[model samples]
Structure formats: structure tokens, C-alpha cells
Target: MHLKLLYCTVLSLIYGLALGSPAISDSSALADLLESSDKFNDHSVVQAFVEELKAISHSSRNISKCDQCVARLAVGKSLALLRPDLVPPVFTQWCTETQYMSNSTCLSTFSRNTVKSSYTGTNFADMLTLMDPFGYDGQLYCCYKESACSKPKTPDVSLSHKWPAKQTKHKVAPVPSANDTFNVLHLSDFHIELDYTIGAEANCSASMCCTPHSKNTFANLTSHSHKDWNSYYDSHYEGNSLVKGSLIDVFKNDSIWSPATTFGHYECDAPEILINSSLDSIANFSSTNNIDFEFAIFTGDAVDHDELSLTSYEVTVNSEEAVFRDIKNKLGDVPVYSVLGNHDTFPYGELGQENHGFSNYFAWNAELMADLWEDYGWLGSDESQYARKHYTGFSVETSMGLKVISLNSNVWYKKNHYAYWNASQPDTFGQLDFLIDELVESESKDQRVWIIAHIPFSADALPLPAKLFAEVIERFSPYTIANIFFGHTHLDQFEILYSGPGGDAKTIENVVASSWISQAVTPWVENNPSWRYYSVDKKTFSIMNAYNYYTKLNETFTNNGSAPVWEFEYSSREGYNVTWPESAPLNATYWHKVASMVNESVEYNQVYENYAKRFSPYVPDCASTDDCALDYCYLTSFTVDQYDSCVENVKNNK
Candidate 1:
């Protein structure tokens, strides 16, 4: 019989660690040893394989780890090899696995150097299986703060997370009519990787912006990050680098890029330190700023992008739960509505809908949001009752009677693989109809409504037909709709839909269906990681002004002995200077001016640069003038017809 049959575990563990998965090979010495046994094939084949292994063995120490392991496979080991006492399976597995595994530590007698060390002995798979993807779970691997990278951190005492000090007074200026104002925190896309230091290069270009999806090409690390340190310097700081917070800046402040990542499969997500720090940072900011958030809307894509490991249902459930649970811990009593991003669902962009009696997996996923989010004041808790087909669009009315509708816009995502299925569903699975009903209810009661969804409305691949969606929006824009908030584009953008029905009808007399697409908090692409807090009119429910904030990736806590700057970056009404008639801020008239400037060849640059604010200066990389103009037009357009019109305007301008 072949030796491999006798020693499968030893060989499998070594192969999995040294090479990459524990998959069997056809050309390996083990394969030859297994196939060329006297009972299986030519005995000469076994002899040749042993000679080849011996050739490699003599170049190393006498029956070293590799030799001993290989020797066991080729020549066969004594029956003692099977004894767990002589060589425990855990030790054997860990030594090889930890050495080769990307995120691991060698079990130090007194030191905790496993997370970053290339040494072996730790069981990373065991650690990973215990991880809570969102926040601190004892199961995740973390180092002690006092002796970081040297000692492992014991689990935090699981208890009720301490909440922020209660809000006593309002700070910002309220609207003209109302005596009060509501603060809404819009946070999106935090691609938190647990261990990024494993393979992080000195000048990986994705440092400031996004991590390229091609980082998983296996052979070579093909990242969108800057090629060298000099290019990175030139791109971020020019020559005048902000010499503070250096260590904690970039994609991962406290850690390095994970070497163990593959699609859907990951060795880790945000470590407890980093994840808790982020939440603490936000809490501290809000406290120091005297900000009292009435509510918050976290536009989806909570899970990190470019998952190398294939996600399973169990994984999806764990990750999704961890995210919401951690948010609850951090925010405390602050009610925040959430929607599933394309990445939030299993299988990346495929949003599966229910068929016949078959439960749609996406619906199941959305139901998880419903079940977990009920404590956060999600009114659509009764899953079977509130859903419009698989689309989860339900309204939660506040004590003051302000209605907020969370729309499952993934049905309209252009990148969604199941768009065809969404389009074919009856009445768009009552998505649009349900929205109209909500709007109608709000209109009758004069209760203004706000929409929070993942994907924004576009003509192509949307939940409802663009025209129908526009008609419903236009019908309601006059009576009750307040603002529509969305993400997924990963950049700061606005959609200005006509408040009235048709062409050039009344530019000044129009109502702006104000929508804001918040920038992603994840420093994945070149987009500056950010979130926005909008000052909303409590009575009118109109957005008065917007304060956008961003984190500087290059600035770390270690830099210049100061904390990284997470300052208020800009304000919409203040920076744009589109004031008309004194009080109507960012209205249709203002949007029209912006759109005109966008189409205006001479004025487009300033306006475009104004909005496309990155951590550093942004240099446009458009191939030609037409390409630039088309993008400008696309951004200017708010509705489906406007998108088409925006395209026409660009072509005609050409």
C-alpha cells in the first residue's frame, strides 16, 4: 500500500501550509509515492520519486522538518508516527500551518508575536472560526496593547457596552421656520480587514484610495496602489507630507494587508482594536462636537469588498450580524436604519428573489436585517406582512409623525446579476406601488418622508421602470418627499430630479428632489473615506446644510505625536456659493446652475474639482474631453430621463 494512505494527515497539513490549499497534486512526490506502489503501478516509479526526493533532501539538514515529513511519505515512517502522544496532531498541524498561514503567530512561551510573525504553531483556522466579523469577539486574534505584536490579547469581558453621554442641547442652526433641527449621520463602506500588515507593501498605491480587486491574482500582487514609495508620496502629500499619524493612516491604520484573503474567503476582518477604535472615535467626535444624532442611515456594503474566500450562508449570517451588533454597541440607543448593499448579500452582486413558494435568499438576508434591527426601531419587523414581493420597503413613523422608508434598491443595481429576475417580478414586486402607497399616506397626513436605500435610482436596471419611478417621485415631490439618501457609487454625488413634470417648465419654481450619495468610509478606492451629517429642517424636513467629514489615511496616531485628523471637511451651502433668494439652499434653481456649469465647458473644471474631493488633490484621468463632459452630464442628471438627456447634452456639445 502507498505511504500517503498511511500518513494522509501529515502530508495534507504540510501541503496546505507550504503551497496553499490542502488539494492533492498529480506531479508531487506524494502523488508519485501513492500511485507507484507495487500494488498500484510500476515499482520503478516509486523508486524514481524517492531518488528525486533524496536529491532535494541531501541539500538540507539531516531529516529536518521537511525531510522528516517527506521521508515519512517517500520511505515511510515507523508505526510510532501514528501515535498522537509522540507527535500530537495539533502541534504538527500548527507548526506547518502557522509558518505558511498569512495571519498567525508562533506560540511564544511568553511573547505574542503570532499575528505578524512568519513563525508557526498557532491555529489560525480555529481562531478565524471564532471571529465576530464586526467587533471584538474573544475568538479573534488580537495583541495586547501594552506589548503589541508580542503578546496575545485575552477577550474583553462581554457586558453591556457603555453608551455616550446623553444629549442635553442642540448646537447647529435650525431652519427658518422650525425651532429645532435633526442631525442625520450618513456612514457607508468601511472595508475593515483584521490583519493587513501581513503582505502590505511600503508603497502599495491603494494606500490612500481603494484596494484593487486584482489583488487576488495569486502569482503577483496586482494592486491599484502606487507602485513605489516616491509615487505614493507624490500622489498623497506631494513633497509636504503631513508628518503625523503615519503608522495609523492609509487603508489599515493599525494593521497590514491580509495575505490570506481570497474571494469570499478571508483570514480576518477588522481586529477588535481597530474596529473599537473607529466606534470610539466617532463617539468622541460626536460628544466633543455637541452633536445629538436624532437618527442615522447607514447605506449598505458593510462587508469588505474583493473577498478572496467564497462566502457561505453561515459566513454571510455571521458577518451581517456582527456588523449590526457592533453598530448597536457603538451608537447605543441611537436608531439607525440599514439596507443590504450588493456586497452585503451572499454571492456578491447576485440579489436572488423568491420564486413561487421558494424563499428568496435575498429576502432571507433582508429578513435578518428586519429581525436584528427591530430594537433599532425598524418598524418592518413582521417579515411576512410588510414585504412587497422580496423587496423590503417599509415606513417607520416617528413620534412626531415623520416617516422614513427604507427601500431595497438592490433590485435596481446595474451590477446585480439577478436584475432580470427583479424586472420580471409582478408589479416590480409591489416595490414602486408600495412606495406610492407610502407617499400617498404621507401626503394625506402632510407627513414628510425620507428614503434610505442602497442603490440610487437610474434608468437602467432599477427596481421600478425609470419613468414610473420618476412619475411616482414627481407626484410626491410636490406634496411630501423630503430627501433620498443612497450609496454604492462610492463617491459623493447628488441627483436633482425635477419637482414638476416636464421640460424647462419652471426652473425657479421647481422642487429639488434632493438626494445625496455619501462617500464610502472604506479606503478601498481613491475615494476619501468619509461620512456626512446633514442639518435637516425639523418642520419642513428639507436639508438645510451638509457637513461632510473625512479621515486622512496618511495621517496616523503615531505621526507627529498627534491623533489622525477627522475634521469637518466641507459644507454644501457654504462651498458651492449657489445661494439664490437667500433661504432656498441647494434647491432646483441651485442644481440647474450646477448642471449648466457642468455643461459649460469653461466652468466645469472648478465645479467638478469642488465636489471630487479626495484625501489629497485629485488629478482627473479622463482619456479625452468628451469622456469628461459625459461624466459631468451624468452627475448632473438626477432621474432616468435626465440621465438620457445628460448623455444627449454631452454628445451634442461634442
Candidate 2:
């Protein structure tokens, strides 16, 4: 019995060895074939055999048909993996049983009708889920109901080329019949400094002016000048340097510094060199063009700091005198009138007292047509104490019928002292009283009034003052204030505010002049640093103008020469026309051409929204204002995609 059992065990062992060795050897061969087939045609029958063998090798117990089935499965997987581009479409057409499988069995399960369905209707989403594990590009194939696939329709991507038509008929107001013609040069924010300082020399060419030196040179010169001047005059004479070293130092040594002597302190002093260059340029332009200006108006910021302190007042007055002298020398007898800026008031000092010493300085510097108490009694019994002796008005005849009303906005700084002092003053209510008085007077005489001030009556970016100013203008509607000219925000924009007796208030046109000191370190300079030139008709009191300004430093220097200058042509008519405020018609064609030219050349970004909100009603008429406000509002409400679309539209239109 033992011998027989031994014989059976030996036979069983031999049988197992023979079978197991072959299976193991086959599995090895299958792995090698599958890996090798990955590089060749995956549709090979041999590749399928290899994959099936791999599956069978891993089974716990061998079945008679396991090897065959494994080989077939491997072949299918190899074909699917290597020829996905071909296999995907075929599988989608034929597969049905296990929707996720790409094998022939699954393919055979689908009905021919189902396989012939449109690609869009095919279970592409499910196929993607199954293929994701294998990292397939699911977009490789799409099934269609027809035997042949059709091309997808192409999308239209061309931009619309039609130009926009003018939305409303913009009627040019009538030209008032006037007899006298006056030539006026409108300038503002003359922050003049003596000698080229505060990057002034940098603005000039080395061949024409001084070479660009290190900041240390500026520092050394400033220190030497301060010590030298202090010893010679008063220690306060430290402000005598033509170019101050650093702003921090200047602020620290404020007492010893004045606006005139210190160069690097503020933007005001830049006008010294700028004005000289500008005057030279203007002279050339005037000679070339044969235009003579009658008078010049400096809107404001005549000095950097308005203070009751003696040194501050002295520096400011001296600076103004120097500017006036320069103007007189350059233009030859053109009287220059200046209105005070917010900075022209005592710095955080007394608001009402006329004898605040700062007021006296202004009075002393002004030509003084009449005493404030004697001429204007609007200030009440304490007029002498609080009224600005320098706050005066004069009428200039642009031609026969056109007149300009230049008023001081600083007067209202008393009630809203915070606006001017805190740098947050809205341009409105502060000057309503003065504006009303001027409007009434101009309307009564039937004179076209060109209201001039330092700060704009309305700015889309800075709207508090604009809204306030708009309300005042609305109160005197249909009176036809020819135009309101201002210069505070530095950028050039036009807003037209037209309010008829019974119609909706229309703030359609408000024109802002650019600053002269274009490249100063100050925020205004960094943003808007161009100047504006105006051309007015003497006979009709009609004004047509353009801003030929740019921000290219080299270009500005090249055109301006060693010193840059600006020029304008002026003429006047014989009589004054007070009855027709809107009568003075502007040249719409010319205006549009100039506007188009400017818009094409310059790029303006939105910087003020909350300010614009104050004057929302008047914004629609303003291209920049409305667009900027809309951009801000859209960004707040929509997704980035929607916001981008709105922005693109504005840019294309502009």
C-alpha cells in the first residue's frame, strides 16, 4: 500500500511541475509581449493573447479556457491603449453591454441603431469618466448617426466695423453779437521755483541746460546754500537753496524753507523753469502765428502753502511777484490776474479774520481795485476782519459781447474750511454765493460769462465738489453760462451741464484744463501733466480749442527746445451780448475732430468712482466719466468675464 501511495504522489508532483512551469513561463512571455506590443500596432492578435495570459496567470486556480480568455482580453486592452484615436470612435459605435468597457464583447452588445446616433447624443460624458482612469484624451473621437461624419459649423469671430452714429443732435449755441475783442491767456497752478530744481534740470537737455547730477550733488548744494544763507541773513534763510535735497528734510526744516528758494520741496517751483521754457516757446509761437494776448489769468495755487506766518506769506508773495514779473517780461504788458487756490489760505490757521496776516499779504500783493469792505458788503459788519482783501473780480471783454468772470473759490473755504484744509474739499457749495452773484450780473448785462476758477465745477473722478457745483449751476438754469473753465484735477475732460426751465438737468459740458507742471513727483503730475490751448472768436464770442499735449518726456523736451513754452491766439468783437448765454456757438465739427484726435492718442484710466457718484445724473454726457463709473460698478456686480466684456466695449468705442 505504501509503495502504491508513493508512486501516486510522485506522479502528482511531476504533473504539477510540468503544468505550473508552463503557466509561469507563459505569464512571463505575456508580460514581455504586452510591453513590447505597446510600441507596435496594439491591434495585433498576439497583443490580445498576451493580455489574456497575464490575467489567467494571476487566477488562483487554472481553468481549461482561462488562458484563451486572458489572451483575448489582453489583445483588446493593447488595441484600445495603443490605437485610442481609432478605437474610441469604433467603441462608441459598437459598445453597449458594459457602457464603460471598450472590448469587442461590449461593442457587440450595442444595437446598430443606437450606434448610429449623433455624436452629440452619444454617452460621451460617461466615456470620459471611464477613460479618465486610463488618461485618455476623450475628445479624440465623436460618433455620428450617419455613416460618415460631418464638419462642425464655424463660429463668426469678426468684429463689427460700423462706426457709431452721434446719439443726439448737439446744437451749437448761437454766437452773441459783440463789439469788443480781448485777448486772454488762461494759465493755472503756477508752482514756480527759482533755478531748475525738483527734476527740472533732468527735464532739460544736457547740451542746452545743466547735466543730470547725482542726488548727492543736490544734497551738498542744498546744505551749503542753507548754511551760507543762514550765516549771511537769518537762520531762516536756510530755505535759500535753489534745489532742496529731500522732502523729509524740507518738511523737518519748514521754518527755514520758503517756496521760492527751495527747489525740491513742492511742484510749484517747477513752473519757474517750465514757465521760462514755455514763455520762450510761446514767444516763438506768437511770432510764428502773429497772435498777441491782452491779459493772462492764473486760476490758482499761486503758492504752495497759504499761512499767516510771515515767512510763508513772504515766500508766496515773492513767488507771485516773480511770476508776474516773468510774465510781464515775456509777453510785454499783458496784465495777469490770479484767484487764490485752497493753498492760498493760512494753513490750518484762522478761517475768517481778515488780519490773519495771510490775508494782508494777499491784499498787499493784489492790485486792489477796491477795498473789500467798500466794494463788496456780502461779508457783513465783520467784513474787514474776515473778508479776503485779495478776493476781487474784474471783467475782460473777449470781444464785443463776451465777458469772463474769474472768482476766488477760497472764500467759501471759510464755511467748509475742512475741504481746503483737509484736502477733501468738494468743489461745490463752497463757492455758490460768489458764483450766483457773478452769474446774475453777467445775465443782467446780456454778457457771455466764461466762469473761471482753479478747481473744476465737476469731475467724474472727484465728484463731491462737482456735484455741489452742479447744483449751484442748476439753480441759475437757462442763463447760459458760456463755459466753466477750471484746472485742479490736471486731466483734460469736458462735461456739459445744460438745465432748461422744465427739462431734465443736463450736465453735458464741463471742460478741465491740464496742469503746466506735467512730470512732477506729485500725484497730479504723475496722472495728468499736459497743458491746454484755446482759440476764441472775437465776433461771435464762440470758442474752439484743442489740447496738443503729450506725456513723452523726450518728445516734450524736443518740441519745447531747451526750455518748453505754450502759446495761444486770441481776438475780440465790438459789443457785449448778455442776453444769449447759449448763443455763443462752438464749432462742433472742429471740436469733434480735436476730441477724436486726443482720444486716439491718449489713454485714460479710471481713478475716481465715489467722487463721480456724487454727480451721477451729469455723467451720461461725459464719455470718460460715464465709462469709468460703469467699469467700477460692473466690476463690483458681475463675474470677471462680464466685467472684461464691458471694459473692452468702452476701449473700442473710445
Candidate 3:
């Protein structure tokens, strides 16, 4: 799961980008310094890594087996992260010019390599170590995003596997709303591992950085100020003073390592206590918030990161059952629409149409809903119409004439291992095509639409082409698609989508759709585990007010003596200071007010930047505002290209 988290978004700077390696005035000079005198050279290092990449590429020229597909992507991405600057010119040119590259799968479109067929299932230690960006950490290679490497990944397989119905959703009075007003409880990323411990100080840290000390995608984030740099270390790093050791040494000495040894990635994955507390609180909030939420949308990844140990199909079924049953019991009869996350499977993160590589990669959780949710009537008894894409999608019509379509966007996941592809050959399923049809049908009947998924169509989830995703979202136009809700990145952020190309070509007013990149309940990384309450336009369905709720970690774990304090954080309409439209608590008219600040007001932009993380978010304020403006603009219409470009342009300017 830590490895998967590697590709997750950066809410402050740019979200969902495989940020290119930092530029260098003289890469050669730095190479020389690193090789001989500086603090970078090493013994186990492969200086001719680029040559090795070529050899690997040449070897896989005629790869016949499907399992190698995993090895190809795994190894290729490892090489890229190991030395992105060392990316061969020929390879980069081919990737950028000849083929269509997904946000994070540049390695796949370009690399033609195959590892031995031994790295499957639970026996992946050596293979992962081979993929390790050699000589990482102070020798502490905690993780390398989506970390498929050597580390103390929690393999907690011994926990109560049954979901309890100790409490059930109580029937309550619905708060009155305008005839057209639509309210939704937006939830994402429960990451509920049956075995994850609560309040455990994880001294072992994990991150997406190329190096243990560096937190950015690139090892050298020279553009960031020292203060911003420190912030990176503060939020991402997990350890004591730098020490020379293997990734395993930390755990070897772990029984009493440090104050907060991050067991794997960040200190997260919900313990049952937390999950129960969270659900109960959210259920309570909907009843008392004085807002009428029509239904709830959980945008995937309800399962957690214990994939290696989750090798059995029974366990996978159990995990899904636990989460689903819990949500049902807590929400009572509220029809909750859920999506499939990458982690919601057996071998973890597999979403191919056929068996590309994994053994038990059948993603039929949604289909199972026919039985699990029949009483709720969302999926009803017949699953054929709803379970087209591995039971990962379905269109539920609300009484308000709004169509909420949950997509199994996992087919686009970076590590879906080419399930849609033909045995390491290029291929694609008609998932998106299916979505277009759904939307078109909705439009024909004059129905407002909302999309919910675990991953956005961005590199963060290793999604399909950015422009293609933009085209999909933009295809709906002015207001057919009211809003999108997603939750893989676990950051309190917003994505703004412009109907046209995402650049200076579009003016601030030329907007099409906006999304709430909802927060996670796991609190695995930066911010406190949180959820959202959205008040949407009765007519257009755009969010009028978004109230964020968080369990302050420090307070919950320690503050007034470890009694988890679940409290309301702030409202989007209130915190960002968007102008209050007299018609609603917040409205598109006022959303435009917030968007205008991104274009014209620095003060407002700063306020927006500070709250991006919801708890302790930061901006490279001391360094530059170009990226900041771009980040603010992203909330307008989130596009991967614009995000990468904004980051690159900002660094180039620096």
C-alpha cells in the first residue's frame, strides 16, 4: 500500500503527476560529485543503470508470457524512479512522441523488459529489493512509492474477520431542503485493514520520493525553500538521525527503535475502534447537521494495504463484507453508492478484463452487492446491468432526478497490470465508452449526473491519458455533470476542469466541472483522517457548501488523554471565504467568487493554499507563487498535464 501511495497526489503543489526529475544546470557535475566526493555515491549502486535499462528493454523484445507484464512495469518504473534524469533520450522521445502514455505508466509504453517469473504472490521480497532505488535512505529504504521493495510492510493477517452489526442506522427525520437541493455525504479511502493497529507510533516512514530524505518526486527539489523543504521532511520522513543500514535493519532493531516508527508507509490504516467511531459519527452528523443528505457516496479503497498477506480469495471476500456490512449497519437504510479501489482485490490492485498476470484478480464486489445490498435496493437483485466492469460500476437514480454513476476506474490504475491489454500487447476495454453511454442516456432524459470513483483520471491513480479524461469530463458540458467525487490521494483538495484545453487558452470563467478530491478515513499520511458533508445546488447539483470533518490525531491519540476527539473542521464555503450567495449557504455564484480569487486575489489564494491539506497544509510561499496560482487553478479544473506543466514551469523559473 505504501508503494501505491507513492503515486498519490500532492495537494499543495500539484496532484497526480509523475513529477519529472528535477532539472540540473550540470547533471554531469552532480553525477561526478555524487560518484566520488559528495554524500551520494555508493558500492551496491549500478552506475550504468541506463545501460541496464537498455539491456532489459532489448531482452523483453519478444516477451511471450503474461506474468512478465507485472515484471515489465515493476522493473521499468523502478528504473525510472531510481534515476529519472538518467532516463534514456531514445526512451523518453519514444514515450513522448510515438505512444500514448498514461500519467504514471511511462515505463510501460517505453520499457521492453521482463523479470524472472518468481515475483508473484507473497514471495516478492527479492524482486522488490531488485526494484529498490539502490542506496536509498541513510540505508533506510522505507519505501519508494507504491513501494514494491524490501520493507516492514505490515502483514497482519490475524484479526477478527467478521463485520459486526452491534449498531445499525437508526431511522431519523430528514431535514427539510429546497425541492431541488441535493445533499451528499462524500466519503473516500477507508483503507480498513482488519489487522491495522490503532494509535501505534510508526517510526518506519514511507514516501513517494526517490530518496528517503527527499520528499518530492525528484531527489533534488532545489526550487523549494529551506522551510518548505523542512515541512516535507516533517510530514513525510519517519526515523531518527540518519543511519547507515539496510531497509530491514530498522525492523531488526525495531522492538524499541524510536518514538514514532512508521511500520510501513505512514502511521495509518483504520483500527476497528477508529472505523466504528468514524461511521457512528458520520451517521450522527447527517441526522444533526440540519442538512438533508439524499444519499452517501464512498469512492473506493475501503480495503487496506495488507495485500501480500491477503492472498486468499476468502479473506478478500471477508474484508469487503466487513466494510460493506459495517457501512450498511451504520447508515441504516441510506442507499450508499460505492466504487472499487485498486486495493479492493485479492492479489491487490488488479483490474484487467482478463487474467493479464494475477491468479485470483476477479473484482466482483459490486456484483456481490446483488446479495449484500439487495435489501437496500440500490443494486436490486439483477446485477447484470450494474456489474458490467467487474461489478465496479452502477448508475443509481435518486428521487431528485440525479444519476450517480460509480465507475470502476481501477481499469485505468497504473498497476492494473495491463488487464485491459492483450498479454503484454497493447489493448483497452470499453469502460470509458460504457461511461459515455451512461452519461448520454442520462442526458437524453434530462438527468443531472455525478461520478464517484476511488481514483481520479490522473497519474495519482495511474489513470488513463489525462487529455482523454479531460475530454470525458468535459464531454458532459456546462452543467450536465454537476460534480465528481473521488478519494485516492487522501488530501483535502479540489480539481477544476475547464471545458477547453487546460492552459492559458482558457479564461477563469470558462469552466465545465469541479470535484471534491475527498479525504481518507485512514489518516495514513499527511492529514488527519477525515470525511466531508456537501450541500449541493438543488437545480445544478454543484456543491453549495462542503463541510470537512476530521479527527485531530494529536487530540484523539493524546490531547486530553487519548479519547479520540471527532469534531467538525470547517466548511468549504466558509473556510475558503467564498462569497455567500443569498440563495444558499454557498452556490456556484459564490464558487465563482472563489475561482476569481485564484485569478485575481492573492490573499484569497493564500487562504485556499493553507487549507489544501485540511490539517497542516503548506505552500512553497517563500519560494514562488506560479505553482501556487496553478494549484489554485487546479481546484477550478484538475488536469494532469496542467499540473505537471505548472510544476515544471515553476521549477524552470526558479
Candidate 4:
């Protein structure tokens, strides 16, 4: 959810990407002094660093994107290596002085240990050691990894394999008058922060707040400014300030902006009690309603979003283990199929593609996830082993003869730096091949397939892979694939994919497929904690309706740790007040109709926006702005190209 914010901050600060912004006067002066020949024993290296900084600043717009990137990478690497001991603290001081990032966030993300660890054992680290400004590795890292330039264009991959001949007209299954349906539980982005503190600063200045280490406010950040470097350095970095003391300690006496509630807060991830409450609610609701779910799909993101300084290998593993265990305990005997989210890993978003040479660096995650799945009886021994080798992706055929293909969609995630290395290829991890194979087999068996993954193939995914995925959907959607499900945006949303790759839908016949982007369980940002379940027609195995449920997060503040009242939010078919034949499945065509309604009717659009974030107070006025039109554009488009074109069309009309 904080993907763009984190990426931009890192690229702008750590990579020295200027982005046409004028350099901060104090930071530039400090850089000049730090790179002076008098301080460094290696004057040549210092001179090289100075020149690179000059090139980055003065010629930022004129230089080739790769050159600009290379210069920034070179300068930053040289500065770090020149005085490994002094660089992190100096950078921390500069970061706080300019208010580029919170002092806690900067120290945690760019500490001496973090910096040193980043430069050790990895291929990227080796590339940095080479110190070749003009090297291909440097250019690749800058151009693709940092995305300093437009990604290289590649030809559209013809449908991975030719699909079966279309039956003159597409055939959709009809819903019977008394549709025999079963429920499907979908929970995503639990994001349980183990160190969550009740009554802590929910309005803290960190990227993620409400944790034990989160600062109370930004008013005290000046205490670590560049002017106080000597004194601050002596007291702060000397003993346990970097490791032992909490960053929250400095602002302990400050009044909290918004005291974190018992259940959760808008600015932070879900606390343990909140996670338990959510699970308890789901269990109680299902039992009370007698809605026996066929199987639950936990679509990734078990770990918390404490990425600034709180994330580590131990935190990730422990958090995931605790969350998964809670799921198993609360929802007994209901097998849960889960996948790894971008935040589920140690470095947050560094999952490596198969055969990418650095794949082993990420093997531990797959292995760990596989072990848990097997122990929890979610997957068979063979299936878990297969997932272990397949980047924690597995396909399991349910007792009902439906093929459930769980994918590790992080291969297409924008935050995973490993994905950008050779991104021009259509399928970086052979996942497309695996998907096609599964779909082909399911089609032959006359079995409907449900594809579940973490990240949606929207703007969050890279263009090439998302395009390939759309093409796959266009090929096999109505015939074999029943639905595609994802969760990452933390909003209750869905997108309709049309017939062509660019998703040009001029007629209802162009509707090919749809993906359900489930709302997150974590109230990260302003979203209320929510979960959803769909009524799937047993005969067609397609979703007939989706029911959303959520609790008022603010209500928990007055309840004194009492369980929040979980209320029925809305249902896809009846809630929106949209018209459709009751006998028809809620497919792409139905969603396309919803988009059309949203585009033309202001009243309906406001209702849609209210339901999106479960009535979060911060929900924007889509009807008053261009967002309703843009939402229409997003819903009607699948591939990135189509999304871009739709956005352009909306802007042009505006």
C-alpha cells in the first residue's frame, strides 16, 4: 500500500535521483565538505564522487536517463564506501535537517548496519564494488531497477499457446432459479504489527505509525539536525541509540496526535488483538449464518508494514508464523490457500525470479511458506514440495473438482527490484507458462479454474507481465478460467478485462474476464478493516454474488477493548442497486455495466465510492472530481496499455 511512497523516497534520497528538484542548500554544502580531498586519503575517489554529483545535479535533464542513474549510483556508492563509519550518520543528519524523511524512518532504513548489509554478498553489492560508472551493471540497475527511464519496448507475445477454436459465440453458464451456491472466504493483508502499542502515536511522523518505535511527532526532529551533528553524534550513535533505545523515547513527553485505539488505527497496520478479533468475527459470523465456506483464500501479506526500521528476517518470519497460526486456530478444518505478498519478505520487496541467479537468496521464503502450508494441512506433501520449488506457488484441485491455482504474483510487482533486471521478457519467472499449462489441463478435464494471487495485475504490476497475463485471460477466460482474485490495493475493487489485449470494449461481446481485488483486512492508511466472501454457483463455479463485511474502527475506541460490531456492508448484486438478470453470473459484462453506471450517474458514483473503503471517513468525493471518470477508466481496462489509453481518453474529454 505504501509502495509508491517508499519507492520514490528511496530513489530520490538513497539513489540521489534529483527528479528536477533543486538540491537542498545545506545538503549540498555538506556533500561538498564530505567529498573534499583534505578529508579522504584517496583524493582521486573523492574527486570522482564530486564530479558525479555535479553531473547528476547540473545535467539531470539533459543527460541520458541511464547516465543520470549511473552517476547517482556511482556517487552514492563512493560516498558510502569512502567513510563507511561516518556516511550513515551524516546521511541521517542531512535527511532530518531537510525533512526528507522522519528521523526514525531514516535511521532504521539507512543505518550503518543496513548500509553495510546492503553492500555484502549480493550481486548488486558486487556491482557497487566494481566502481565502474559506465559499467553495464550500473546502467541496468539505474535504468531498470530505479526505473530512471522508460522501460524498453518489446513485441506483444502471441497467446503463449493457441487457444481452442472459439465457439462462433462465447458461451456463459446460466444461473438456475434456485442456484446451489457455496461461500468463498477471501481475507487479505492482515499486516499484524506484533510491537503495536495501545495509546501510542497513531499520527506519528514515520512512514508507518502506532508501533513502539514510531516517533510522537516531527517537532523534535530538529534535535538531530546537521548543525547539532557533533553533539548528536556523540550521544545518539554512541551507545544503544542506534539499536537499544526506542526512537519513540525522544518524543515521549509530546502530546499524541491521535492515540491508537485498541482494535486498530487508520495510520497503522492491524494490531494482534485486531487480527484476532477479525478472525473471531469471521468464525462467529460463518457459524451463526451456517455459511460453510468451501475453502478460504488468504491472498498474501501476512507480515506488518513496519518497513522503515522494524522489518527484519526475524520480524517477518515471526509475524507470518503468528498470523498463519491464528488463521488455522480460528477457522478450524477450513483449508486456507495463501500466497506471499511483496511485504511478506525480509527486504520487503525483493523476491527473485526463477533461474535469475539470485533466486537462491529468496528460496528461504518459499521454503518457509511451504513448510507452514504443509503443517497446516492446506496443501499435500507433494504440493508443498512443489510450491517450495516454484517460488511458493501451487495448484490444488479441490474436492468439488474445481482447480484452484495459487500464484506468487510478486514476479510482476513493481517494488521487487529483482524483477526489473531483465524485465523486457514477457514471462520473467515462467509463471505464464505454468498458468497456461494449468488452464489447458483444467479445460481438458472440463474443470473451472480459480486463479488467486497477491498483487493485482494493474498499475502495481509491471507492464510487460500484466499484458501477458491479460492475453492469457483473453484466451481462456469464459471457457476454463472462472475468476481471477487479488488483494493489495486495500480497497474493495474489481476490474473487467475485455476481448482484446488493449481491452477496447465497444460492445458487450468484448467482455472476456474479470478480477476481484478484495479489500484488505488491515486498516493501513484510512481503510476500515474488512473481509469478503462470494457466493459461487455450484453448477457453473462462477461467482453469483459477493458479500462484504466491515466494522467501524472508530467505534472500538469507546468500547474499552470490547469486540467491535461487525456489520454487513454490502453485496455485489443487490447493494449497488444496479440492474442485471438474476440468472446471469456477475461476470465482466456485469462489471462493465457498473462502470458505465458510475461514469454517467453521480448518485450511483457516490454510493460506489462510499462502499469502496467501507465508509472510511476519508473517502474522496469522486462525484465532485474527475475520479468517477477515472474509476470508470480503471474498471474497464485490464492491461497497462489499455489503462493508460483509458486515462488519456478521460483527461482529453475533461
Candidate 1 segments whose C-alpha is farther than 4 A from its true place: 1-179, 194-198, 201-278, 307-309, 358-360, 376-390, 421-426, 499-512, 557-563, 601-604, 615-627
- Global lDDT of model 1: 0.49
Provide TM-scores for the models: 0.60, 0.43, 0.62, 0.79
Candidate 4, residues 1-654: lDDT per residue as tens digits? 134223323433534444453442234443545546366565444344444355454654666756666655555544544344444444455445545457775565345242123333332332343334444345445544556655444445666544565453335533434678888899999998888875567768677788777766755443322111110101111111121222223233345546665567889998877777778888888879888888999888988877546678888889989999989888889989998888887677666666745556777888989999999999999889889999889899888878889898778876565564545556768888888888878776767889999888765777778888888887776867888898888888888887743667645778788899989889998988999998988876889999999998877655434466789999999987778988788888888788778878888788878888899877888756765667777777776677877878877876
Of 1 and 2, the candidate ranking higher by lDDT: 1
The best candidate by lDDT is 4
Off by over 4 Å in 3: 1-182, 198-201, 205-266, 288-292, 306-315, 354-360, 363-366, 383-385, 388-391, 419-427, 461-464, 559-562, 584-606, 616-630, 633-637
Better of 3 and 4 by TM-score: 4
Model 2 lDDT per residue over 193-264, tens place: 333332223222121112122123233234223322111001111111222233323223322222122212
Greater TM-score among 2 and 3 belongs to 3
Query: What's model 2's overall lDDT?
Result: 0.35
TM-score of 4: 0.79
True-structure RMSD for candidate 4 = 10.5
Query: Candidate 4 overall Cα lDDT vs. reference?
Result: 0.70
Q: Weakest 10 consecutive residues, lDDT, candidate 4?
A: 227-236
Best candidate, TM-score-wise? 4
Per-residue alpha-carbon lDDT of candidate 3 for residues 260-316, written as tens digits (9 for 90 to 100): 212212344665445666777776666686655678888878666552422345556
Each prediction's whole-model lDDT (CA):
0.49, 0.35, 0.50, 0.70
RMSD in angstroms, all models? 18.2, 29.1, 16.8, 10.5
Per-residue lDDT over 438-534 for candidate 1, one digit per residue giving the tens place of the 0 to 100 score: 7766665667788888777652333234445555665566347777788877777776666444332325356445577777665455444567788
